[model samples]
Target: MADVATKHPMEDEVKKTEASSLVGKLETDVEIKASADKFHHMFAGKPHHVSKASPGNIQGCDLHEGDWGTVGSIVFWNYVHDGEAKVAKERIEAVEPDKNLITFRVIEGDLMKEYKSFLLTIQVTPKPGGPGSIVHWHLEYEKISEEVAHPETLLQFCVEVSKEIDEHLLAEEEEVKTPETPSLVGKLETDVEIKASAEKFHHMFAGKPHHVSKASPGNIQGCDLHEGDWGQVGSIVFWNYVHDGEAKVAKERIEAVEPDKNLITFRVIDGDLMKEYKSFLLTIQVTPKLGGPGSIVHWHLEYEKISEEVAHPETLLQFCVEVSKEIDEHLLAEE
Candidate 1:
């Protein structure tokens, strides 16, 4: 976050009145403990959520033109700067998803008053042999006059905001996936009524699974992905569970996610259940209840017993019921 203008070789030339229109560049690199794709996706597709991730600095963001994540889209921001309120309007100039790069050009705001033009680009890449990524922020600008100071504050702001986002990402990755455990086989179907949004509930299980452990830590000790990313079909998830006075673990792969129908299916590939069951599959479907704000959550478990001595899945059903209730209450509290 050092002021590059003072030490840079071009310092005198940049301050010369004759070179007022000369473009000045500043760049900073930060390492964060998060997926590169996830961090890039936050700015590309979910910029509006930045306030939630860094409430102290960013107050809000609104779409002014086109759609989010699209080139040429205009976004307006309300933020705090130098202990004062400020605003900025920017247009997305470029987006390279494969390379995890996004560029924005300042179109209007306080920055325009001092600079002829300003461009901000962010690139993220995975760190080799590590669990995190490195983020690079590059700023290119031309001052309108020699009186304009270098954009040192703006560069510091970006670094601080990146740190806040990195902390949020690291917190979500704390969920632990344990080793395989014993298993059993049987079929059980039950339904519970929930006065909550079906789409929200489905999204919780699909994308924000880290929150699942937070909501029902007693029944679900932790959850982590073994293969692929969360919310994608075929992604494998390992769950640590406490059931019937015993600790258990299950490894399952997502078979389907039908957001339109509010349904998700998971088929167990290996786990504690495999010890007693030949196969196990779980499906959850949420539908809005008639004439109300509630939803009917249907839990279906299909399994083949390894032997006749295997007990039924009564306790398992109760576990699901309790977890669902806990999640319901968590969602309600947030509202």
Candidate 2:
């Protein structure tokens, strides 16, 4: 208090000017003619596919670090900017699939020359009273100097890319809806309630699938690992089981394991089932029950039958339900 100093009005004005001029933000919204889920998946899960959607604008995108669709992963993008070829390396800062939002921070590239920092965020929301989506693009940046221009062109580039991606997704959706011939693909799903936690239920299949045979000895006789560690993606596993009163063996590859979502997917590579179905994929997902200690276990089967005469996997789904009940009982007994 003895040496308190007051700031001058001119000083305060200059300080405010400097603070406002150092940082910038730009936002734009685009109307997308694709479903929000599909649009979000294009950027968050399969950004590499963007080049194919807009080959004239985007040359390619590749994983530089970490896996796809994960935060902290770095991706390198080669694209056209102002008719000039440019490259940008960016890190995934955030991903919120529930909200269909993804954020990226530029680490290195042509844009770094003028900006000290740059962040791009995209959020897709379903359009009200419509079948399409609304995509919002936002940019946050800090300039090296006040003379640097705002990145209006980059914002426009994002809008164009979004439209191109939406077009591609719409085309694919149409193709799926009206295939040239009768499609063999079919899906079967069932849900069962369990007296075990979702984590434990998912872990049984992801980490210790071999122990499943102990739980349902009648249905699952044994399970053995053929390659890679348990719970790892791309691992090959062999299963000996009984289906329709006959013993059957299946060799499957673990396609994906999303522990956060309590989901695992297995694709059959060799098995008696493959004889009737050209391809068979099994997905198991668990979700904790609300206001309870148990969980809901969901089994999803996706298959392409070799012919229309091949019956749907109703019996197989029944077998899964029986096995799930047995495993739930086994887990409850352990508890």
Candidate 3:
């Protein structure tokens, strides 16, 4: 395996220079000290139990450069075993031992055509305190065109692989969605206590945004909520509002619900919210990551759209974004 790139080496010629402005970057680092052992065990070798035989395996993702564990080796898969899928080949460019960093380049594959090239660096960097570690990822890419899919496809793969790894690590144990008992919500803010317990507060926070009464163009302005079984799955809800001063509305139907897990989802039924939008789904879930207190709230969303105008999910996504923060503040104030 090659050594990790410590310094950003300067290139003399502009042979491979980029002109496009940096679009955006998303980073999700987690300090999972308790999971260190599990990680080491699962990654000790080719995870046969995890099985790399499936299609879309991207060949050699398990191998790295220089012929070490997942290094210096290339592997391939048929994606869904549809029997007709493209092959991908990548080479491990650099590997750091102490830092647990591995960098690779997809030198051969269909992806290279549209992506030109991409640098995927994964490192398990140590956190400031104790034995904790951060799964650090750095992705630098040269887009092939304005129509190229930038981060969506890559992000989805990262998330899925993360989940799979987590699943493998916690194989023997099951996640207690809703414990037999409600975990003690340690040191909650007083306001959060009063508000969360208040009928109006729960009513406001439980469903869609009650604050926005209209959907103004380019904005999540006016909107209202309508739903059956407000917090359960199979529950249907509708939002009518104005964006940028224009009246609009989208009907939503609940597709899934895991109450014990405090998760409920809704599919957008109708709306001109985005020209590229054909459908949207929202998931509201509350997880007590800190057990008694200090819970990290994660509001997960999934969308599949067709229109270019409505493809930008930022505006519509803002509602969930704000709610997560609001919930955190409300909890802290009461703590």
Candidate 4:
């Protein structure tokens, strides 16, 4: 006969005591004189670059498996903690670009000797009405026994490295600043294949943008002539559209019209987009597919962000793609 197990009377109480004593969490925030996006990007996408920024604390970092900025990637880090050289092997648990957060779980390291598990998270947020950011660090750990010390020294090391990185970034920004150039600028480009003639696609954007809303009713609510005449340089148009589930508007001045090349350029002069960008420029070029019955549409975006808190205009580019696809389908149906 199998023996029946019986629970001890003090088992529940002992379990509670062990849980409360072994598991702990630590958190701290440090003010930084650097852009939050840049800082977050470095850790999330380019951790190897961090060694140059804080050589004293972070000697080096290398990818052991998978690609950078991806979950389940293993990374090895060499560093100094509490005046002693140390190393850590970590796996990326999560990467949230929109939230500017990255989480690393220590899988094998010196800490594992004393702790059963350890997790580190870093999040950066832009300072309110200012030119800096705040870095928040959080640590969750479960010690093997209550006799082990809390990881306060490791948290302090993180704070010191953060300050060092901020100084390095500030220096780099100052070196690139100038009287005529914006401090931070970015560009994005994408191409789409459409079953529509290049001439019709070009004419739709350059000559008859006012009719675009009808072709892409869901993406574009409406468009109206704001200034000048259509199909001419210096003409202005206003666009109302939905982006990332929010309604937005843009007032663009026709900067260039190249009929021979089937290209058109629009520069945003005012609207909700300007609130986040110092200047935003968009260009569209369409060409007949060499070996097909349709056309190829090239979309480009160039912009300078007002601050690091503002994310790149990826959703705007996606909006352009959706509008192009819808217009292509509409044109094909008409044909």
Q: Give the number of the best model, judged by lDDT.
A: 2
For residue 153, give model 2's deviation from the true position in Å: 0.8
lDDT tens digits, residues 211-286, model 4?
A: 8888999888888897889878999899998888888899999999999879999999999989999999999988
Models 1 onward score TM values of 0.49, 0.52, 0.37, 0.49
Across 1-335, the per-residue lDDT of candidate 3 in tens digits comes to: 12222322223111233556333333344444435444433333333223432224322232212233356644222232223455455665665555565666677766677777776666665555576455545666777776865554564454455455655455434433545422221111101112232222232335534443321222344344455565445555566554444667776776876655555566777666434454456655443321123232334455545532333455545554554445445544544
Q: Which pairs clash in the backbone of model 2?
A: none
Off by over 4 Å in 1: 1-22, 175-335
Question: Would you list the C-alpha lDDT of every candidate in the order shown?
Answer: 0.80, 0.85, 0.46, 0.83
Model 2 CA deviation exceeding 4 Å by range? 1-18, 182-335
lDDT of 4: 0.83
Ranking by lDDT: 2, 4, 1, 3
In model 4, what are the clashing residue pairs, if there are any? Answer: none
Candidate 1 lDDT, 1-335, residue by residue in tens: 23322233334423333554456777777778889998898789878668878888998665656677899987778889788888888999999999888999998888899999999998888887888888888788888876888887887899888988888766645522223222333457766777788888887788877689888988898989899988889999999989998999999999999998788999989989899888888898876643347676778898887876888777898898999999999899999
